[model samples]
Every structure is written in C-alpha cells, then in structure tokens.
Target: MTTAPPISPRLLKGALIGVDLFNPLASIIVFQYNPDTMTRRLEPRSMTGADGDRGEAYRLSGAPKETITLSVEIDAADQLADVNPVAVASGVGPSLAALEMLLYPKSLAVIANAAIAAVGGIEILPTSGPMVLFVWGPSRVLPVRVGAMTITEDAFDTLLNPTRAKVELTLHVMSYNDLALTSPGNALFTVHQITKEVLATANIFNSAQNLGTALQL
Candidate 1:
C-alpha cells in the first residue's frame, strides 16, 4: 500500500526593510525566529473639546499615531553546531551590526559633512538614513521609524563575540501625515490604511452573518 507524504505547514518570517530615499540600495533583515508577542498602542488624533468647539469634538485630524514594541531573540547555537564559518568566526556580530545600522547615518555622508565643516562652511544639513518599513505580515506592512532599541547580550564565544542576544525595539508607525505626499512611505501608509479598512469591513460582515443566524432573523 502506498502512503501519502506528510504535509508541512508554511511559516512566514517577519522582517525590517530599509530603502534608500535617493539610491537603489536596500537592506532586508529577516527575523531568525518570530517574536512570541507583539504589543501595539494607538493614540487617536481627534479634536479636543478644550478648544471650546463642541462641533469639532467628533472630528479627526488624521490617522492615529501607532507604536509597536517587540523583543527579538538571536542565537548562534544552531549555526555553531553546524560549524558555519561566519558563526564560528564572529558569532552573531554581523547580525547585531545589521540591526544597529538602521539608526545610523551613512558613513560617506558623515565624512562629507565633516569635510565641509572643516572648510569653515556653515548651514550643513543633517543626514537622514534610509526609510525603514516594519513588515509583520502582508496586511501589517507599514513605514516606521526606529524610536528606540535596547540590546542585551546574553552569551559570548571564546573571542568575546556575542552568541546569544535579545533586542527590544520600539517602532513608531509613519502615517501619511508624517511623510511627504510625493514619498514612497506616504503611498505605502495609504495602502496600509486601505487594507485595514477592507479587513474591518470583512470582519463586520462576518459578525452580521453570525448574528443573523443566532437570532434567526
């Protein structure tokens, strides 16, 4: 008798994608293991009654400000066991560096600014890093800025290279109001909102159907 092969469920990994504003360069850091839990908070942008305008109390200025906090764990035990060259050599240093670089200005830009300053030039503009997108899933991909990060190195290899670490990240969602109208981040945020609305509508429809069945109406 022939037996069917066992089916394996597909798993998705969350990632952070950084796209340069003026160049074709991009950085994608896929999480090794998905976080166990993610915390999200939203603050509404509604008009306040303190303005003495009762009519404007129900008005909203823009999309709510949203923030997400998650803790990601990184470990090199598996790689080290398999004798991976990079892991054996530097442990998780490269992985840690990749995450840390999200908040850093480009080295070339920093050098150029310093050169200009050395020449007694003023009015040098500050450098901005690439725009980062926090992608939890298809429906949850949104532009975000790294508000804060805390890294804890749990273990190290013989060379003092970190073998295990946990990174706690606070991401501030960038809504349309926070980005330029012509920028890609703005477009992405608009699509994200539309997707959310569509999902909410679907949820309501399902709930109505269940309610009708329950009431036999």
Candidate 2:
C-alpha cells in the first residue's frame, strides 16, 4: 500500500530541456533510467471438480503505478530516500517552488509551439528562399532561414533524431485560423498553402537544436 513520492524538478545539465518532437530528450546518447515502480497482481484460478463441475473464476486488480502528473509516473516508492530531502527542502515553500511549477507547463507549451513551427517550415521549404521560418519557444517567436528558405529534409530529420535513438521530442505547429482582411490589390496566398507550409516547418529547427546540443555535449 506504500509508494514512493515523485522526484522534484531538476535541471537537465549541459543540454537545455527542449520542447522538440521527442521527450526522453535527444541529447541522451544513453541514460541510466530508473523505471517507475511496478506492482505484481495475484488472482485465483478456476478449475473443474472431480465431480465434473466447474466454478466461475474471479478477477482481481493489482497495485497501481504511482502517478506524478495526470499522465506520468514520478517513480516508485523506494527511490526517494537516496534522493536527498535536504536538497528538496529548498523547494518546499510556496515561493520559488510554486512559482516554478506554475510556470513549467507554459514553458513547455511555448517551446513545443516554437519547435513545431521551426520544424514544419524547414521540412517543407529547406531551400533558403521565399519561405518564412518561424521559431516558437517559451519566451519568443523567432524566424530562422538558411539564407533564404532552403532547408534539406535530410538535415531536418537528422536534427530531430541525430543519434538515431534520441527520441524525446514535442514539436507542434499552430493550426490555421481564418480571418477576414482587406486585400492589397487582390493578393494570392491561399490559406491551405500557408497552413501547410507553416505546419511543415514548425518543429524542425528546435529538434535540430536539440540534437545539435546533445551531440556537442
């Protein structure tokens, strides 16, 4: 019935926590993963009696994996002791800890959005011309262009999965929002084309940055 508490926020060293298309994080050549606690279930089995009669079997549920977030496991019940309460004590108050935790999701969202834009653009128009490069991140939206808009597909994919196994990414492009506007002498960029391009290039850059940082580290 006992379980371990979840680990606190720890800054990933050398490599920045990126909101790329992956999450185990691309900078990881390998990691000593401490798996979340797991439980084993025990249930009764039905059998036929010597009198040629059988009994119905009942099902049982096992212990649960402790949840850290709504969809994630913090870890098992046993790993907390070695984790250093003194180190975690600094974050217990409602000041810095609460503030940082509140900001975490938004930070993730910003990075996720930006990565999506950068990746999508680079993937579709890796040529360094005519196309727009948009980088969406937690703090700002930056535009990236390889001189023009010339981006190589190989380069983009390479950046996302550089080690071929760095799979922690979370890239996402913003969806199209249609708006009515006055035309500048009957201009011609269609909603479909723009949407397609933007989504295509969204996450490529962040993924690339992630991979680049990982490889460098």
Candidate 3:
C-alpha cells in the first residue's frame, strides 16, 4: 500500500493557493516599460475667418505599462519562508510575507488608477468572472468575489434537483498545483478525511505579518 505525502507547513488561517490556472507554473516575470514618446499631428490648413488657423505640435512622454511577473522557484523554500511582509486593508496592499495563489470574500468593483488599469489582470475569486492579475507589483492582495455555483458539486440527482446538499459556496484561488480548496470545500475535504494537503493560507492577506496568528484549518 502507498502512503500519502505529508502536508507542508500546517494549514494556517483558512488560506488557499490560487491563480486563474491550476498547478501554477513558476515563472520569472517583471512588468515595466520604457518611456513612450507620442507625437501630435499639426492641424490641417483651413481658411481662418477671424483668427489665423492655429496648429501646434506637442510631445507626450511617459513610462509605458507592463505587468511585472515574478518567478517562484520550488527549491528556495528557505528564502520564501524568510520574507517578512506587512499587512494592509483588505483592498489596498501587497501580499508578501508568504505566497498564496488564491484570495476570497471579495468586495464590489475594484477601482484602480489609470496606470494600474493598463496591465493585464485576473480576479482571484471563483465568481468574479476571472479577474486580471497583472505582472506589475510586488506580492500584493488582489481583491475578488466568488459564488458557490461554480465551485460546488450537486449530490444525488433528484426529481427537482434535490441533490443540493453538496453545494459549494465560497471563494478560492487555484493552487500552484490547481486545487480549488476553500471555505465550505475545506469542510467537505476535512469531513471526508481527504488526506490531501490543504494548500490553504490565511484568509487575511496580512496575517503573515503577524507570525503568531495561526489559521483555522
């Protein structure tokens, strides 16, 4: 008989590793752009009734936009554990300290400045209709919302769809290995004695900053 693999550091504070894609591939990424030089065309010559037709050329120069992509190496477990991160409000901040692929309990529409909007992004939640996780910043918290419909499974087909007990309601991020583990789902797995490692992290992005707080697995 084969034994199951031991879980990594114990499951802390209801956390899950998520990405739009499962089994996240560690990639080396960075988002940055050189200045953009724009040229304005001079206006066409037209008959001026009162004032001479005025036309001018102006140049706009600014940094281009790129989502910074960071690489995650599997062997550097020691370095990853040493990162001391800071916590911020649910909606505003980078999630360092530790690495998690998913985030949940989303908020409403996320408002970003013009620059933050230019890059590609993904929503971490299952119901946010796939958000955009751009490659532009350090470890950060990207807020999103999810529904139970997409993540849950219906049990025992019935006359009027009576198999509703298995409905999964909650948010989850894809694991570095494509796992949809979250709120009610975790309960399901644990209850069934699913011996898989809970790729779960703290529901709070900043919880990593306070090492003393352990997650509720």
- Which candidate leads the pack in lDDT? 1
* Cα lDDT computed for each candidate against the true fold: 0.90, 0.29, 0.28
TM-score pick, better of 1 and 3:
1
Question: Cα miss at 162, model 1 (Å)?
Answer: 0.4
The better candidate by TM-score, 1 or 2, is 1
Error of 3 at 145 (Å): 9.4
Candidate 1: misplaced stretches above 4 Å?
21-26, 49-52, 213-217
Q: In lDDT terms, how accurate is model 2? A: 0.29
lDDT of 3 by residue, 1-217 (tens): 9999987873222222333332243211221121122121223223343454454222222111112222221122232245422211111012221222133312233334323445855443234323323221222232223322222223222222212222122332222122245533333324322222223333345556554565433
- How do all the candidates rank in terms of lDDT, highest first? 1, 2, 3
- Report the lDDT tens digits of candidate 2 across residue range 1-217: 9788998986432111222332333211112232233222322222433454334323322112111111111221222245545324322122222212211333555565667787774433221111121222222221211121111112112123211111121212121211123521112223434554787798789899999999999
Query: In candidate 1, what are the lDDT values of residues 1-217, reduced to their tens digit?
Result: 9999999888899999888755434467789999999999999988775765887787898999999999999999999999999999999888888888889888889999999999999999999988898988887788999999999999999899999999999999999989999988899999999988998988998998999999996
Looking at candidate 2, what is the lDDT of residue 132? 20
On the 0 to 100 scale, the lDDT of residue 79 in model 3 is: 26
Count backbone clashes in candidate 3: 37
Candidate 2 stretches greater than 4 Å from native: 1-70, 75-79, 83-173, 176-217
lDDT score at residue 88, model 1, on the 0-100 scale: 98
Return the TM-score for each candidate structure: 0.93, 0.16, 0.16
What's the CA RMSD for each of the models? Answer: 2.0, 26.3, 25.2
Error of 1 at 97 (Å): 0.5
Give the Cα error of residue 164 in candidate 1, in Å.
0.7
